[model samples]
Target: MPIIQFQLIPHTTQDGLPYQHLRFQITTEDGLMEPQDLKGLKLPENVQWSQGIVIEGKGPIWLYGYLVHECHPSSWVGCYDPRLGIVVVSSHTHAVKVGNVLPIQLPA
Candidate 1:
């Protein structure tokens, strides 16, 4: 199996609010995955469930809500920010950088 990487996209929603959503891309896989492929998606054994995909700096970005969208295989997964009313697709992920070291965690 290949390692699946996910990123967060920051954009405004229809109402023009700040928000971000998750977008997944396979690192070593040949093609995109279907919605069904995410049914039982789980992190690797070395990863911790408490770890979340960092969007900003060292802190974790919390999702206001989660939604399932009808999208192509290349970009899948959607989330909504009620506070800012923003929505994002095919977003990017941020890694915590400190001096010469960097740490990153993925959403479980």
Candidate 2:
């Protein structure tokens, strides 16, 4: 259960339209990145279901989104944006801050 932490970077969709749904580009300190295709991505249960409104378009969709983002056994993950509620782990191509606080999962 090696947990690896990363940051979530928000971006506009390809169409340049900003729709709902937590979107991000995952990245790591060692330069490891991956696409969090929820369809096949084996992320934590907390990261999966907490995407949008439980009823989906029912009560009130989340303004930003989940925070924990997404993850896989690869040790990649994201967290609730302390700034924005936007969830969805990202893998962007930016130099991970020199000392960004991140979570570290234990080895299984």
Candidate 3:
């Protein structure tokens, strides 16, 4: 599995809804891969998403979601699977930051 570092940059939609731009990078034997960005992800509100959080990856498709911090116990949990091209979020409450990892999984 590859470990990726992610940073969430804040943005607002034309309709005035808050969203984030997910910027991340992965390192491989070939060296550090190019940084990629996923725009307009409407994540949970009120949680302070951190920058440079490291996470593990399964393959070319990465999962972006929230986690529970001792200080931040969230009632809501959500995930954004780029492979599925959809955002799945359940009931809302307190929350913490977001992180993910991305690796190009070559076929066996």
Candidate 4:
């Protein structure tokens, strides 16, 4: 498996703290699915989605915090890191199992 890197220039807060984005894609048995199709898909636990996506110390450490923030589907108003990874699809939008798959969307 290869690591799909999403180049995210960390957002500088007014306080000068850098906030990184967590972008990743889910890997099914077939391969990495299209980001648009992720909204309503099912992913097994054995799926190799992380692979080389997350390389510790390679980028900003705050990306983990962004991942945690994005994981919560209730807050559907945040920016989706245009990377290859999972997303939090809200039950309010579709009839999907909340944890079925992570939402992956390319930046528009």
Instruction: Compare the candidates by TM-score and give the number of the best one.
Output: 3
Q: For residues 26-76, could you state the per-residue lDDT of candidate 2 as single tens digits?
A: 333453423342234332233332222110111112211323232222122
Error of 3 at 88 (Å): 4.8
Give the residue spans of candidate 2 off by over 4 A.
Answer: 19-108
List lDDT for all candidates, in order. Answer: 0.33, 0.28, 0.33, 0.34
Q: Residue 62 error for model 1, in Å? A: 24
lDDT of 3: 0.33
The order of the candidates by TM-score, greatest first, is: 3, 1, 4, 2
lDDT of 4 at 23: 40
Give residue 28's error in model 2 in angstroms: 11
Q: Of the pair 2 and 4, which is ahead by TM-score? A: 4
For residue 72, give model 3's deviation from the true position in Å.
Answer: 10
Clashes of 2: 12
Score residue 103 of candidate 4 by CA lDDT. 40
Candidates in order, TM-scores: namely 0.28, 0.18, 0.33, 0.21
Per-residue lDDT of model 4, residues 1-108, tens digit only: 332333332332233322233345433455444444434333223322222121112323354444434344332213333362333333333333334333433322
lDDT of 3 by residue, 1-108 (tens): 444454454543233333343444454665343324223323334444432122223324433332322112333323334463213243243332233222222111
lDDT at 41, model 4: 32
Off by over 4 Å in 1: 32-108
